[model samples]
Target: MGMRNHELVPLQLIAVIASLKHGGCHKVLRELVRYKLVAYDATARRKSSNNEGYRLTNLGYDYLALKALSSRDAIYSVGNQIGVGKESDVYIVANENDEQMILKLHRLGRTCFRQLKNKREYLNHRQAS
Candidate 1:
């Protein structure tokens, strides 16, 4: 999909892009929202409007990345998360031949509050003064 300024896309537009019936497209979107893969804004639907909106969550993007990797034979099984750092999580994965690999997912625009405070303790001291 091409990048758009709006995060929430209209249901009708999505239906037209996917070439699916409006009802069918809504059903698929409902399922994704139920799984927390998509965010739905029913508040946007006015009394006279039938259009709803949806946007993919971070988990949804991660799911797409995982699907692409598996389809390309880069990952077969997702093993346990071996490490968690300030910016990312490292996972041990395996390929078709059982070769071990590392998968690191970086958190964009996210951070652990506790870790952030600890890492920037000096800044906190300056503010108090």
Candidate 2:
């Protein structure tokens, strides 16, 4: 629930980290997996680890990070969009003390993903021609 690691975490380790009941944690994990927030690998040795477990997907990480930021008074309510760029979304957000702040969601990774998709399609068409 806290630490963010690329390595797969065993269920037992997760229970220990979150200090939650095993049964409840299992149910919650199932829900998260269903929502595509968590990715579960049944096969071990994928990451050269003997234990198979779950890890947060990119979406899950983003959700957790935003939640943490909100809890820490980094952002309060979101207002209208102030500006945006090709790889980011800028919005006016407020802090706990009602101070306005500019929150930018930098989606630079998505830009690369989009470019890859476009290039792949273009290549396929070129091959046909």
Candidate 3:
């Protein structure tokens, strides 16, 4: 979908694209909606059994832009998706030096916070090793 488009997207599609579990995607989406970063529409509630849909608000787009700019390594461009895992998606990214790098977006803690916390701590410990 276009960045400016406000089309209502199904939760399943978003979950698949982000490599996040359905429950986790829903939780995060609720938070985003609460923060006004995403809009959840239930207009089809009467017509359809699955009534929920989501669309990114302008704030969400701005947040993404800010995150990109604040990164230590300047990202020149984002390329195609390289891989998709259970909890993340890997994409090809080009840095200021034109070096190709893999960018992984992790979707942790959709179902259980304990598991996410454990995994995060393990990663932090490994990084500090």
Question: Which digits, one per residue and each the tens of the lDDT, describe model 2 over residues 4-36?
Answer: 342477788888888879998899899999999
Instruction: Give me the displacement of residue 109 in model 3, in angstroms.
Output: 35
The lowest-lDDT stretch of 10 consecutive residues in candidate 1 is: 120-129
The parts of candidate 1 lying over 4 Å away from their true place are 1-4, 42-52, 111-129
lDDT ranking from best to worst? 1, 2, 3
In each prediction, how many residue pairs overlap at the backbone (N, C-alpha, C within less than 3 A)? 0, 0, 1
True-structure Cα RMSD, model 2: 8.7
lDDT leader: 1
* Residue 23 displacement (Å), model 1: 0.4
| Model 1: per-residue Cα lDDT over 1-129, one tens digit each | 411433467777788888999889989988998999989875644387664478777788778889999999899999999998878788999999999999998765366654444444333443332
Error of 2 at 78 (Å): 4.4
RMSD of each: 8.8, 8.7, 14.5
Candidates in order, TM-scores: namely 0.70, 0.57, 0.46
**Shift in Å, residue 121, candidate 3:** 42
Candidate 2: which stretches are off by over 4 Å?
1-6, 44-51, 78-100, 105-129
lDDT, candidate 3, 1-129, per-residue tens: 322232467788788878899999988988998999988786764454655578766557645864775485567778898897776667887888889877776665545655654555333333222
